[model samples]
Target: MRAVACVLFILSLVWDSVRADNSISSLKMAAASWEGELPCKEWNCECAFKQRGCCCAATDLQEVEDQIFHKVMDLSRRVFQLGDTILEVLGGIRVAFTASMSHKKTCFGPFTRSTPIPYNLLTFNHGSGYNPALGIFTAPRPGLYSFSFSVYSKVQGEGEKMYYKVQLMRNGEAVVSTWEDNREDSEDSSSQTVLLSLEQGGQVYVQLLSGRQLCGNIEGLNTFSGALIYPTLT
Candidate 1:
């Protein structure tokens, strides 16, 4: 019994250096009956008995197991913290925005030819992407975006034709357009929506074609809105 206790002490000394990654080593001096376990491998049992020791007692061995568990738990916490930081960084770059110009009375008129209608009254500017002064949305990130606009106008009399036309413009190029010409109706309105993949710093705006007159009432029905659908920025 004394020799067994001496041998177990020697094996415990080897535990610190051999076990670094938290894996439990198999018992070398294992008993045939359910008494206790030894830490050394099965093949080296005779060498361990002759040189160092058998294995630690259950109480001392439990302390080592407890220490290992705590270390593994601490490692798990560090991993989780790193994952959360990455997610927060990723969330900050997800591009999204929605903006619109007001429904109040706005008019661009009486030009001999088409002109760009600058919608001046901004009702809602989410993400501050829409500029009421410049009437432009400069993309903050590269992504697939959806843009929509509505135009409304009316003539003074019932029989008069209303020429209301506008185009969705991207970086000075016309993309999609909407137009209204009255037959029986004095007031005409049209709306158009387009999906475009834009790069960072690209500009999009609603342009009132030259020679056409357009006006929207105080209800602020005329609006231009856009939002990022798929983000291209990391």
Candidate 2:
């Protein structure tokens, strides 16, 4: 009876070991399927199980990391290409206008001014004379632009001086304006700079105002100035 019991006990132990092995083998096969690899053979179950578990885990992680890397690379490339395109467009659409006095006249003084005033400052020339009612300059292209102007004037008397006004306009709207009052028998100069986002076919203009004559040297009192437009990164 004891011998028979020993044999049965040994058989039970073997059966349990086989069952545990079968469970491990089934788990490894499932893992292998997840990894898209070949299934384990019955004879090489141990090695296949180990390899499938490790390969499936590593492959999942690698796929996630690769997806993230590709997304980031695509975004970076798009931004770089957009920057290049903006630079190319800006390089093509800058415009500038310079203004100089071509004629000067005095009503009731020994005025001794010369025509074609010196190019001592900056200015702009529109198709028509400057009108205060119209305030903006249209752009020739849609872009980021900068505007600048300078005013040159001669001081006459308390009432008789030259007043010059500089303005930045976009689509007939005044974005900025500056004025110089030179009525105090002293030389006067003023300037202004502005940044604007302008559309194509916009216009800009400058206006001048003259004060009454005074008791100073009003003769040779003319001015020159202009506007420059260029593209900017900001």
Candidate 3:
């Protein structure tokens, strides 16, 4: 029992001496690194003398963590922006409309200048892009669209002029035209269909050229229709 106690006492002394040496070495290193500066004076850090530059180590770790946190926040903001763009694209899925002149036995025009035709009857307006008042169909999104229009006119006499010139227009520019100036037929109708790639807010409509007239039962016979094939998100 006495020999065991002696061994334990010697072990305790050796451990104390080692601990004292480690503590002195740590203090020396700290003093050498910050010779004339106050501990943690220039940094948000916990000061410690038990390990060399422990305060600076903590401050560097905090700076790295802050950088990582800022990067995460920026990525999150980008993700939300992408999600909003996707929702907006999906919002205008299927767009289509069919419109015609009001139900009446009337005459359209033999105007001095070119005029846009107001197809005021709305048979279908899936996306509400067509404006009966404005006589235009504005594209709600960029896409490939198919547009069709028909023109009809009738004259009282066989020798009378059945003159009519109708055009499909895109943003004030004429795309396609149909006309019948001969008196061979007392009444006639012509239709045109076109496929157009359009950007958002692009406008399309039917227009009558100058010095032309559409007279007679030209109600539902004069028609304009369009449908979106697919979106081009660019």
Give per-model TM-scores. 0.59, 0.36, 0.60
Query: What would the TM-score be for candidate 3 when compared with the true structure?
Result: 0.60
Model 1, CA-based lDDT: 0.67
Off by over 4 Å in 3: 1-91
In candidate 3, how many Å is residue 194 off?
0.5
**What shift in Å separates residue 149 of candidate 1 from its native position after superposition?**
1.6
On the 0 to 100 scale, the lDDT of residue 143 in model 3 is 94
- List ranges where model 1 is wrong by over 4 Å: 1-87, 103-106, 112-115, 119-127, 216-218
Worst 10 residues of 1 by lDDT: 25-34
Local accuracy of candidate 1 as per-residue lDDT tens digits, 1-234: 444654555446455444654333333323222234443333244554445543334345678799999999999999999999998866655554444445544456757765555557655554567677778888877888998888777676657767767889998899999887765767776788889989888999887777777654614566777887877754
Pitting candidate 1 against candidate 2, the one with the higher TM-score is 1
Model 3, 133-158: lDDT tens digits are 97899998899999999988899666
Listed per model in order, the count of residue pairs whose N, CA or C atoms clash below 3 Å is 14, 15, 0
> lDDT scores for all predictions?
0.67, 0.45, 0.80
**What is the alpha-carbon lDDT for the whole of candidate 3?**
0.80
